[model samples]
Target: MAYELYYWDGIQGRGEFVRLALEEAGAEYIDITRESGRGRGTGAMLAIMQSDGEALPPFAPPFLKDGDLIISHVANILLYLGPKLGLVPDDEALRYVVNGLQLTITDFVAEVHDTHHPIATSLYYEDQKEEAKARSAAFIKERIPKFLGYFEKVLNQNPEGSDYIVGNALTYVDLSLFQIVEGLVYAFPKAMSNYRGSYPLLAALRDRVERRPNITHYLRSDRRLAFNTEGIFRHYPELDIGVS
Candidate 1:
């Protein structure tokens, strides 16, 4: 049976990471909101969020329905899909290593989200622009380097080689890294460009992930949503420079 992916229909947001992996692996799945002609728009997401069933629901978008299992949380979802999709090795040791890397990625993602809404998610960026500026500064000056450095360390320590994050083959960790790099570049072009050269392995991995046939096709197709302020990683000029 095909998997049922439940996510806000609009803006790639967190869902894009899952989408990229599924597409890359050529996994069969149905995008629920999209099929109802209610996906791919912000309205669809608003409806999902406002629904009373959300609390008991998966807790967030990017959840997947596989047979009787309903899974949420990006990292947890990947942990479940990685094995079934053959994106990870069969070895228990290697799988745990990849899961550890994934949890680190989750930390990085949360920090990224906080850059724009350091004060509170309930407040709008315009209302907390000043705080966001301060947060963004810390993120670019300290957090980005630290997280990137950790990933670089992982790559360097991967005795298997810097070609992939786990063993000698492609894994969900690699895909998550690609998403991180892409999101960072999109949300902070100047900062990302300035520091990108320092991490050659990560840059190469991003390039390889993009070149994969499935990813290339999805990106070129209209299915991919362009990044904008509506998503978690919004690019505000003032926030980018620690002003306003």
Candidate 2:
């Protein structure tokens, strides 16, 4: 059976990470929120979220419905899908290691979101512009390098001495990192002007992930959405510290 993914209709948001994994593995799935039917749109996602069943309800979007299980959270959803889609290592220890990498990316994504919505998610970006500028300055100057550099260290220290994050092969973590790099580049182009020189391994991995057969097709197809101000990564020049 095909997987049913629940997420917002517009921005890529956290949902794009899961979408990347499923696409790379060529898994059959339905992006239910984007579908154009009565039972297959955002209402479908709301119904699931508002259900009063005994099962635990997800607090947000980017949840997956597979068989009888409803998995939510980007990392949690990927944790379950990785094994099924052959995007993780067979060794149990290494799988957990990759999971750690994915969780770190989750933290990095949260920080990126805070760059634009520093004060509060409920408030408009305009309302928080001054605070966002201050927060983003610190984020671009510190957090970006800290997070991206950590991933660089991971790629450089891979025991197998491969380009991939975990083993010599691609894992879901690699896909997540690729998505993060893409988002950072889009949201902070001025700040990322030297990304290749600063984080060569991570940069190379992003390029390689882009060229993967399935990913290449997906990027060229309409299924892929462009990064926008509405998403976690928003481009606001004044917020960035620029290339230092």
Best by TM-score: 2
Model 1 earns a TM-score of 0.90
- Flag regions of model 2 displaced more than 4 Å: none
Q: Taking the tens digit of each residue's C-alpha lDDT, what string does model 2 give over 11-63?
A: 99999999999999999999998897869999888988999973788899999
Q: Per-residue alpha-carbon lDDT of model 1 for 63-133, expressed as tens digits?
A: 77788677888888988888888899889888988888889988888899999888889998788888888
Tell me the deviation in Å of residue 33 in model 2: 0.8
TM-score of each: 0.90, 0.98
Q: lDDT score of model 1? A: 0.81
The 10-residue segment of model 2 with minimum total lDDT is: 235-244
What TM-score would you give candidate 2 relative to the actual structure? 0.98
Model 1 misplacement above 4 A: 37-56, 242-244
Alpha carbon deviation, residue 189, candidate 2 (Å)? 0.5
